[model samples]
Target chain A: MQQKQVLLLTKSIKEKAIKEFYSKERPTTLCIADLGCSSAELNTLGVVAELIETIENARQDLGNGSQEYQVYLNDLPGNDFNTIFRSIASFEDSLKKQIGSNNFGHCFVNGVPGSFYGRLFPTNHLHFVHSSYSLMWLSQVPIGIEDNKENIYIASTSPPNVTEAYYDQFEKDFTMFLSCRSKEVVPGGIMVLTILGRTSTEKYSKESSYEWDLLATVLNDMVLEGFIEEEKLHTFNIPQYTPSAEEIRFIMEKEGSFILSQVDVSEISWEANEHYYKNDLPKTAFTHYDFVKCMRSVAEPLLVNHFGESIIEELFKRYLETVQVAMTKEKNVFINVTVSLTRKG
Target chain B: MQQKQVLLLTKSIKEKAIKEFYSKERPTTLCIADLGCSSAELNTLGVVAELIETIENARQDLGNGSQEYQVYLNDLPGNDFNTIFRSIASFEDSLKKQIGSNNFGHCFVNGVPGSFYGRLFPTNHLHFVHSSYSLMWLSQVPIGIEDNKENIYIASTSPPNVTEAYYDQFEKDFTMFLSCRSKEVVPGGIMVLTILGRTSTEKYSKESSYEWDLLATVLNDMVLEGFIEEEKLHTFNIPQYTPSAEEIRFIMEKEGSFILSQVDVSEISWEANEHYYKNDLPKTAFTHYDFVKCMRSVAEPLLVNHFGESIIEELFKRYLETVQVAMTKEKNVFINVTVSLTRKG
Candidate 1:
């Protein structure tokens, strides 16, 4: 899901960067940042490479031939920094090989460990900022939602108060994020965010809440089979929320630091991986095994922390069976929202 | 010694910065770096604070109301970084108190750990570079000089070949330093360096080599007293060199990256600290006690590494007696050199 969204985000950046390059006196040095850049080698490097290639192409088109670049990769202090440092050499080498050393601008890549809720870089230092599939995560789980029994996230079964709490938390986090970036980003700088959200303005839209509902059902089944205690489900709430387009615009305007240039909503099938199947079968054909593997890679660490290591294999096996039965009844789709913003002068 | 030199170096920077600010389009964000900033709290913070105050004053004089700053402190990886990190908060707080928070520009200070002989910053990112009491120390002891018996540094009794090797190493290290800075610094940037050097062109001038001779004499006395092995003296050589003014200019031009702007040399009496002694005093105001305390603070670690810890007190006591007799003959003075350069366009 994130891979597909990243492609769309980079495409949008490519389209607008040329105009941004020429709109102001061209900066001799370009400063770009990726906030919440985790230490996943392939995905992180792919995003960075695409960003650099697009910026370089735009600079060439505008006849700004000698621009240098400084790229800052930021994440929390507890992130897997050793892995990122070990992989930097190959990332730089591959970029140089693909772009040709002479044609590519000089790039200095560095890591910044901190939260994005406050200042990171010097004031007016950054020219472009990009975040994808990251802003959906709140700083922490919303207050007063711990009693949302048997629900891991903002599900359809959650009470009205729980829904209000999640909405309020999202608004505060989004406003602070914008306020911090506004000080670091130069006037007229561009920021693009691809967030997980809902197509409708309903408080508990099925399209955005159904996935967590399915996850809760699997845990409840484990409880009945005596695989886990029932109280554990009530204690764990995912630090995540999906908002509607209107909610995002309201907070952005109230923050009063950015001008909304564009907002795009796209629908992607939950079985998007089926399109890459090598066998001669229908495009919609995907097994429960594939879906379970994808979910495990994304959620394994969080799950392992809550549930001990001994129960992981058994828990996911049961989850696979539950997901298989759901696929037969109806096709599930995810709504992704991409917003483009310009720093206000 | 270094505190006095830093004041002079920062004054030179203040005078030229206003002209540089007006000569070209003013930069919205100013980047400054101090290469070889070791973990000494008072000296390091004093140097940084003065540099920031001077730059801020220059910007105001030019009527540039708002300019942000990014300061990079560079040193080797093995330096005592914990001390520097612990001191940064107080450093920033003191600066804010002196210059009101609203009047001061936003300054971001970060540490860059590496050798300055190689690239440590993004290309063309830096506006000004300052180094003091640091460039005199070479990267390592010059090749083939380890066999200069009973001498730990450049001295009057050292052979001609030893002198030639030191000069050759200085030239190579200085050239590489310029080459790396050339790429990192913006065109028209200014660099100020205060180097320890000689007043005369002779390779073994007494003005530069006599201090080391005195140190060597004290060490030889320790060996005879059975406190340390004689062979230990032969294996130790300090990684230091003092070049002539002609050598510095030659390297600046030969590297072809910077133009020499100004070179100033001054002399200070070795007993300059004695001026603080006021009121009535005994005829023999020099007891070896004060001299030993000063030398131990500066050279204790180097001596302890060569000789055992048990001999430190005895060695410095003997060193003080020898220095007191030398001072009686004539007041010893050291020759200091300060050079300014501008990056070529």
Candidate 2:
């Protein structure tokens, strides 16, 4: 769903940049990098396939159909690279069937395991970079937010200091990210990113923080029932933040390594895929099960680390009930921010 | 021993090229690739360390002391990368002790698991490439040598067709090698290789083929004693060759992608390190045990694939006896050839 939205938002810019790269750079072998390319949804390669198709189309249109591609799938060191490698043979075969074996043979894919915050490729080697649904994650939870014992993330009830900590951390991390990428990307290289952001400039907006508020309520109930320690809840904070457009632009401009080519903002309903909302059926179709499942996959590591593995199922069960009740009262939506930038010479 | 000799032969050339690279390219991040870098000796990183030291010294001399390095250690996919990664921490620490921590932090080392017969990196990314004592092994043994049953490699006793087949295979493999590296290395990049070669123009010279002749004698004895089948021996030629320097020059010029910078040939006595010759001791010191052990490490896989596991110990015992007797009769030496080339624009 995130990929579909991101692709929809950046379709024109992506196509334009690919054509420009073919006509201007004229690189016989184009190198591309996909950062934070996790294999959970099995759609990372789909993104690479789309990128390759675009380049192939542009190359053919420009009378350079023989250009080769070297695609790198990058993720953290602990990601499931084994599964990715195991699936590569079939993936290549399918691509060959789609693009014809002669053209498909020009593409080579390899896994690069590392953090995106550091330099992973040779300088000025990459021509195009794509990242989606990954930059919102801070390297770690904002420092000094421990005193916000009742909340797992920035919330309306929290003091101003909590929000300030998160904003400062994002500024530091995003600046470092742009700085590293500036060195890796070649002159006139293009980078497209889809990130979680808030439409409102206000830090305490309910649309962005309410999901965490409901999750906090679920964990509070668990603590009251003696399912987990209150201290563990107090010590744990989610290593995620949704930035505002102003915040993102501020960092990009401050870093001054790239020129923003385009920025688009769109909203996704929290209950966008609920059966009741999709089919216009009765309210009985409304359930938080899907939401709980999706959020659990993202947050399980932190939950398991803090509360142990035994209580995960029960915790999420309570989370589903809490979210189901809160969803009827508030129609929360998440802001999706897509930005395209051209690397400076 | 091979590593030491290769490094000694290329020391002056490597140093000179590094200095020229610093003055000409002035790359802030130097990329170096070491192909056929197996971890069997646990000293592949030592080679990288030596390369880094040379580059660092050159950079400092050119007033570019802050330049960083990225070293790629490449080998077949079946290599023991776990051992290499396990030893990397200590390797980095030792490097830090030698060069200050600030300088050590500038170097990054990674394992690239793949064959050198194809592309393993981005085009024009590498500045300096080194390979040693590995190019002699063809991807597979030459076809049609199956009919030549008396020897396991090119030998004077073998049919003329057998020598032709081996030579044809080397030409194919070496041509593909140069073609691939030409695309990967940047214009003016330097590649230094130390390959096993023969000094004589004759394809079946005793200097290169006598080792296999003695091994064949050992295997024949095993067949006579009913320890192994004679038919298995006939089909098991080693996938290796020692090309003449002229043959190498011919292929390089034919490929026409690189200019020959330097070529040197040297010979090492077969018994150079044997205790008998080192100390002028009695015949009791005439042990082929070291030779047997070294060859077994290299040939065990092929031998086990042909002969059953049960006969390995007995086969090597006979091999030791055969080598000891041959050493008394005929002194043998191996010819080592080192060549340096510059990639053309």
lDDT (10s digit) by residue, model 1, range B220-265: 8878887778888888777778888888998889999998887877
| Candidate number of the best TM-score | 2
lDDT of each: 0.74, 0.79
Output the number of the DockQ-best candidate: 2
lDDT string, candidate 1, A144-193, tens digits: 98669888887777899999999999998999999999999888888878
RMSD (Cα, Å) for all candidates, in order, is 8.6, 5.6
- Please give each candidate's TM-score: 0.64, 0.77
Q: What is the lDDT, from 0 to 100, of the residue A229 in candidate 2? A: 86
Residues A301-343, candidate 2, lDDT per residue (tens digit)?
8889888899998888888888887777766677888788899
Per-prediction DockQ comes to: 0.14, 0.16
Please list the residue runs of candidate 1 whose C-alpha ends up more than 4 Å from where it truly belongs after superposition: A8-13, A18-25, A58-64, A81-89, A101-104, A214-235, A268-333, B1-30, B34-67, B73-173, B179-250, B253-345
Error of 2 at A195 (Å): 1.9
